[model samples]
Target: MTMNALTASAAALFFNHDGEVLIVNPTYKDHWNLPGGAVDIEQGENPYDAAVREVREELGITPPIGRLLVHAWLTVPGRGAQVLYVFDGGVLDHDTQAAITLQASELSEYRFCPPHGMEDGLIPPHLAGVWQQALIAHAEDRITYVPVRL
Candidate 1:
């Protein structure tokens, strides 16, 4: 029997008092995304830990990461399959927001956007839908599963 390997990633969803979600513009990608990266599964890193680590590496702050919000199973056509975990990063106070130090090599900027504005920044467009669902799941204190194909 043969085994198939699927990639995994974890992201942290942060928001402001105004209910705006935080999104980052990556230097390598044309569209914006949440703070996160691929899970280091080969190194024994889990989704939760990857979310925490990615946040620290990207934002330069160790904010409290809360409950899981969404688990997306995505198929990227020729790129194979991937599982994405989105976790609640809680609200970022002004002080914490001011302390952000982006990894210039990987990120260009970060901004807080209203839920309705996510579609304007996210790539593939469907990501905005995933994030919107995540926001809903966050509010309801539940988790959601989204399947996306591209």
Candidate 2:
């Protein structure tokens, strides 16, 4: 059997004070990216848990899961499809000033980004819309309460 090239995944759009963003620089491709991954369609898998797991795996720290940030559909050049689950989280604690048990294979660096400085940062262009949506959700007060899709 073969798996579809397109896939659904969850990502975190963490934020800090003064309109800054939390980002992880992937060690795999040496590119900065949001923290997230594909869903595990198991017996009792939770999206929030998945998000927390991803943060721990990638950043060597725990991010306080605050609320549902927003949703995005990404389109990569070669990847067939990209449906992303974005969440708003807060940085609880860590020594970003130095290094933790960094996921050397997946992430090399992590940083808190000021809103204005992100223009020159190396994030996927496809995630621009995602960032916009996250901001909107945050302002509207709906970010912390995403409704279930039934």
Candidate 3:
């Protein structure tokens, strides 16, 4: 049996003191996304490193990434088979939130969105589901492995 090769991506979940999650509006994509990008394995960058790098590149912040939150295996249409690593960005204080500066070429704007209405606010149905699972895992203080059809 031939096994399909899998690509990897990493994202970080940042929640404000009010519990609103941070989402970014990228200039290249119509939908909003979590702060992250694909792992730069070619440059010897691991998933965790990718997460940290993406945050700094996209948001211009160097907040410490917390524990691993979720591991999602998805067969994203067009993107193909992949594994996604989500890390906890922890709660962002007012001072940290004030420090964010968006990369104009990549991102347009960012917002702290209340968790309750994420499905209506976030783009791509799969992300909403994954975010929901991630939220639960964060609250439970455990890592969740998600295998879902997207």
| Model 1 spans with C-alpha error above 4 angstroms | 1-5
Task: Estimate, for each residue in 1-150, the C-alpha lDDT of model 1 and write its tens digit.
Answer: 113458999999999999999999999888899999999999999999999999999999999999999999987765678899999999999999999999998999999988888876474486777888899999999999999986
Error of 2 at 78 (Å): 9.3
- By lDDT, the better pick of 1 and 2 is 1
**lDDT of residue 78 for candidate 2:** 50
Measured on C-alpha atoms, candidate 2 has an lDDT of 0.63
Q: Highest TM-score: give the candidate number.
A: 1
Q: Between candidates 1 and 3, which one is better according to TM-score?
A: 1
- Which segments of candidate 2 are over 4 A away from where they belong? 1-5, 42-44, 75-80, 91-101, 143-150
Task: Rate residue 127 of model 3 by lDDT.
Answer: 74
lDDT of 3 by residue, 14-124 (tens): 999999999998888868889998998789999999999999998899999998999998875555688899999999999989999999999989998888667895666
- In candidate 3, which residue ranges exceed 4 Å CA deviation? 1-5, 77-79
Query: How many clashing pairs does model 3 include?
Result: 0
Candidate 1: lDDT over CA atoms?
0.90
In angstroms, how far off is 33's CA in candidate 2? 1.2
Q: Tell me the tens digit of each residue's lDDT in model 2 across 12-129.
A: 7766555577777876654577777666646355667778787777766675677777755544445455556777775434354243356778777777787545556477555555
Rank candidates, TM-score, best first.
1, 3, 2
Q: What range of 10 consecutive residues in model 3 has the weakest lDDT sum?
A: 1-10
